[model samples]
Target: MTLPDPADQADNPVGGVRTTSTVSAPTARAAWSITFLVMILQTVNFADKAVLGIVARPLSEDLGLSNADIGLLGSVFYVLFVITGLAGGFIADRVRIVWVLLGMALLWSLVQIPVLLVGTFTALIISRVLLGAAEGPAGALNNVAVFGWFPKSKRGLPSAVVTSGTSLSKILVAPALTVIVAAYGWKAAFWTLMIVGLVWAAVWLVVGKDGPYSVNSARERAKAGSAGKVERVGFLRIAALPTFWGGVLGMFALYGMVAVILTWLPSYFEQGLGLSRVNSGLLFALPSVTGMASMLLVSFLTDRLVGRGMTVRISRGMVSVVALFVCGGMLAALPLVDSAWLAVFLVVAGYGVGVASYPLMNVTVAHVSPERQVASTLGVFTALFSTSGILAPWLTGRLVDAATTPAEGYTTAFQIFGVVAIIGAVVMALTVNPERDRARIAAIDPLACADSSADDKY
Candidate 1:
């Protein structure tokens, strides 16, 4: 048997329905509905990943886990995270994304149950592995689904809203889960996460469905009457793009910085700074709240600028470049402060400004790739960045273990990654010229620029 070309399938609907138009109220409503659901699920997803970090101390003491063991536990999740994400990207393009999301949510909830029941390092390891596999594709695919709802120029704010869930979960989930862990045990926190996952799955089943505009760039172009034929560009060509390379390095730096903060922040406060658990939790929420506000503001500004006919390089790329530099500066100062409160403030500011670039990174890749290829492009993007997830936990663990004090180890880690982030910012500023890249992408395949001339109703 032979498989169908995704490019062809994107252009030619099987049911002969006209679903790719911007002039419909019903479609707009559905798009918003799906975007809202994506936000909720994404929040829950981050919450699930975060629970382990929140409980890391207690779990380590309870299970008698060494620093290396904890590092292995964190690293184990990414063992499958990268491979599944690559496959998930392809599956997302070829299959119904609704079912993909549903299945992943279901599996994630089920896997968490085993850890709560067994409550051992082995069981916890197993749970993390399975959950990682389930979540690997989620980030990329959810963005793909969200992007399907809006036209190219209108994607920034919606994408920011989705990405903001990561920060929002820290705000909402952190304090609550911390209390749950304090009152009950780390096991109870796992149970709460499981329940949240199940609830999100139920809501998704009732309301989730793919958007009509889920077709690729070629089909979108045909709809706009800008092109007469569809084209399929290879991954090699996309890989050669400067925008791609810049996104690769910049996203890796950004994700690594965020991952370090998320996985180690609580530990840093409790173990390094001698804060109470509740105080640590409350402090952890600060950066996320700041991040939530910053992301929304930056994304909205980028969208408004784009709508006003600003080139994406100036509107989105430069904004991210500036934010990255700010993030690096803050991280570099985090360990330099004499006061604990000042240190917290610096770290929070770092996380806040660093994440301001998240949504723009998604938009940057979308701007330079075809619509059909966006998910795969983002999947590869997420997978590459996700290595930070592996490295942050394990490397921080090792550095701390090797140090004379936890504070010194953490200080070293922060300074090193801070420098790396500034370098990434430099690369982004130098390499990503979105105006030139967009035109180059259009030359490679005109469909990538579909409806660019369409009046901005959004």
Candidate 2:
């Protein structure tokens, strides 16, 4: 259970796993338990990130902030999230992922707990910055941890399930956090997340192993010598890949929509639809719950389908397009709806679509990129896309400012999101590399229809 001391990634390529301790026995049950633990940590990870958004009003009022200022909170997290994401990937490529996750989980949990003390905007912002910093390592290491544990074909479902951490966190946080705020004031939300985070850290220690090597992965990697043989690349070479930029643009838009919705949903419901804070929180949690289900369904189908020979373009990209279409439909219908609750339902449905896109797009990015640089490339990808965190929230806030009512904001913001998703679908459609993507899937799973013998006919 020894951890890698933080070090330069270049000195030891496999993050110096040679220093890692003994391997444990592998079993279907242990893998499932490990997978569940990953999901729990992920839940804490996202719950902390999302609490500010879920309880936006009370916190903002206590700190004397405006919509524009609230939006910037996302910026702090995204900035750190992006920067850390870059470094995390590199570290993941070089480091012992389990230990990296173990350390990050502990730090990030402590960071989220401090929001209880901040009454001033400056203090709140500083608190957010600290939380963001902790999140950086958590986000990066989590990806590496996932990659280290699961095979490529099997990775999609487990990854998506783990990724459902965000959705599940929102599900719990939106409703429960809203209630906590109503009962105990804004500070309770932060304290609550802090408690949950610390608990998750303890759980990880008890259940989490160092890597696949500690249990089953060691035997599997030994069987496939190529597992540990990936080469590390310099930043400049990684920067030059078109696929890198493509990932950036795609992820940017993806995260942009996600960030905007996270930051704006409560405000939109309260101000636009005129729902009470408690009601809005409860309603908001609904989509996220639905999103969790959709995510698992999409990821499971993705792995099985791709394993059966579906193209990445068709599998990942097309599945993502489903979210865009639904989101668009929800937006387009917003203005026409008379019932406030109905409109809320529509928007929540759109969020469901947003949930579906998360893991599929990530897996797509991983598939196209070289494995050695997956973390670095992913880091840059998250950073650039998360850069949208800076822009989308501001623009959406402006849209909120201009709207005559919460309903109007809901209608307008959603329409804009719909158009954005449509454009994304078009771009994704043009980039369908089914054959190449098929090869990528095949590389991860021997049974995936990646054989040259079948290539010519397809």
Candidate 3:
């Protein structure tokens, strides 16, 4: 149950740089335990997101709100998302990540109380804004935490596993929350989530600690003169790379579709497709189930490819290109289909295939970034792409409002997402050269590319 000592490991190469090696079997089990915990953490984080969408219809009805108003409510959550994601990244880099995660979880629970107590539009806005801010860094931090337990070559699967937590939330918790909303009403769903967040926070507080591969652990090694320090580079240097921006752009498009799904997919199923609330909720979860399977498959293949000596351009970059392209094509075809079943298939296959790019893009960025700047780089990356959260939902709302029919509006929105995904795929194809970017980083700051083993000592 105890974490393995990094001092027991030998030198290892990670992402083209020498670093501390892998843990023993028992240590790896402990690491995997941490990974599983963070995966659950991600589950809770996404459950918070999916709840608003599950209750969107009922809440809008209760508030007597228009489509535009509902969309604005969804958009408001991300008003503070980008800013907090950036700030949280810097904070995580400086502070103990365990503490940062703890603080965020506690805040998530507190934010829900606003909606529970007031049940007003203004109160809902307040809750969404606060919750968005708290959860903004969750994605980046979750990746960083899980990465701390694994070496570069083995990171893809864990990253996918962590990101799949969102899929898990949609597939499992969303349906359950839908029932809760059905039985107890929208405010009751908020109350339930608040309790869930609190319970998770309590568990995390007891079990959470930095992994052996964490910056905190590295700093301890440096203090003991057992590890050589990797010089920290300015954020700008890391940001300037094409790999960074390309990955960001790809993720931006993908996450935009994700935002639309989380905020509007259930509504689409209910209103656009003419499904019952329960059925809509179930259908709402279908894409995520496919998405989860796709991500795991892609990650497993990607890790295997990397392990087999394939270049990242082929393993990570090309995989993203293919997935995004498939997603785009499926989405574009959605409006063209006549049957509801066909439309559902397009959605499931499109979104499911498209989301696999998320883990690959994350690993690509992490691979190219200076180890010391990974947190900040990831923070900035998350912040930039997350702007889509603000735009996608609001824009979809406006589009739907402008359309003559609900189905027309929803299909138009899906088409736009399709186009964006295609563009992202092209960009990723052109720019996601992890080996080249790694070399570029090393050339810019040689010390940053030095062996990480000095920092790897537990």
Candidate 4:
């Protein structure tokens, strides 16, 4: 059998494959620019989602929403978001992502406007539903664009940069929107995010582009028509793989924790800890600051280690498993802490440590996937993992409603999900062997894996 190109060995220590030669300075600049914009765009994307949770308390009062109602409100966005994401990923695989991103950003921004004007529970629901639909494809597409710009070996930082937006948005949105909501009311917060979306869209229209890799990938797909087409690993086959399931399960647990935090953290502070809204916002942003640092550190370290010839399993997989366990423990200890500062420290530290896994997980999926299926596979991952958003918000709300005290509700919710995180960590640690999965995928898609080594027995 022909050996995989030595060039393919460079990008990732384990299974990564990049279709480009050594990057030129100008190309590197462009790639980094794209990475920066992706980070900003993700910041905007999450800001939109998080704004609702930030405003949830006041919005509930203005419209007479119960905890259950609030839960439903948060869940509405994912209803169509997931469905549209499925279609959107298929489209991204076949087309330029630049326009798709622009259109979605514009629509989500416009959707925010009606909520500010109409100011009703139904209006909020409609706005969130539309926003959700528009943003559904955002995660998959954004990552596709980012990955296109950089090689697999260099992906960790960019991936982390993009994923960091979720945490970064917490840093910015929580404090800024808190002040806005406090001063001008919750509607102002909506208006602020709308402007943010519109501005981000405008900037993206100027700077946004699908990188050369994406262009080349699309051309390859076009040329592979009919007879030249390679049979890809089936969706079910992909789903059945240990790597995929582990990633999905692990992400599900972590994301569930994230959802609960975004939707209820402020409420917890206000109702459970007896903190003021501003203080809650400040505290919320605090953990995210730590998260931002942790994100960058983890990504940088992964790349450095991989470059130094460490196994991907050690550099990426083990790191993530440890972070998950640490995060889970911190969360489980959250309800046990009585001091306000201790509670804040625990929550913040948990989220910060948890973020270390985001980029590693995304890179793992890419390293093990067929080149043409990257976007679609990521969409599938997103779809599966995003179920956490649906279950977490609704369940937390239900729990809170069932409890006599909001503190009890919040405590019970944290402890339960904490266990989930640990379970996911254990499964992921055992199952996500990148080397094994890479070989399995290569066996069925030789053409797709041409750039990848086929001789490694690991």
What are the lDDT figures for the candidates, one per model?
Answer: 0.77, 0.64, 0.82, 0.78
Candidate No. with top lDDT: 3
* RMSD of candidate 3 to true structure, Å: 3.2
Q: Which candidate order results from sorting by TM-score in descending order?
A: 3, 4, 1, 2
Better of 2 and 4 by lDDT: 4
Pairs in steric clash, model 3:
227-454, 228-454
Q: What is the lDDT of residue 97 in candidate 4?
A: 75
Per-residue C-alpha lDDT of model 1 across residues 229-324, encoded as one tens digit per residue: 445468777767888788788878877777777777888888788898788876778888889899999999989998888888888898999999
Clashes by residue pair, model 2: 15-94, 15-95, 24-214, 86-379, 89-375, 212-218, 252-385, 271-406, 272-406, 272-407
Over 4 Å off in model 1, which ranges? 1-22, 27-29, 216-230, 447-458
For model 3 the local lDDT of residue 187 reads 86
In candidate 1, which residue pairs get closer than 3 Å at backbone N, Cα or C atoms, i.e. clash?
Answer: none
Cα deviation of 68 in candidate 3 (Å)? 0.9
Could you give candidate 2's per-residue lDDT for residues 1-458 as a string of tens digits?
22221111113232122232333335656676777788788878777767777768886776677777887776676666667766776666566567667777778767754456655677667777777767765543455466555545556787787788778777776688888889998788888877877887787787777544221232233324444443333555445444445545555556677777777787777877787887877766777877888889988988888778776667777778667666666766677788877887777777787668767766666655444445655566666667777677777766666777646655776777667666665565555353464354335443212111111112
For model 1, the local distance difference test gives 0.77
In candidate 2, position 223 carries an lDDT of 29
Q: On TM-score, who's better, 1 or 2? A: 1
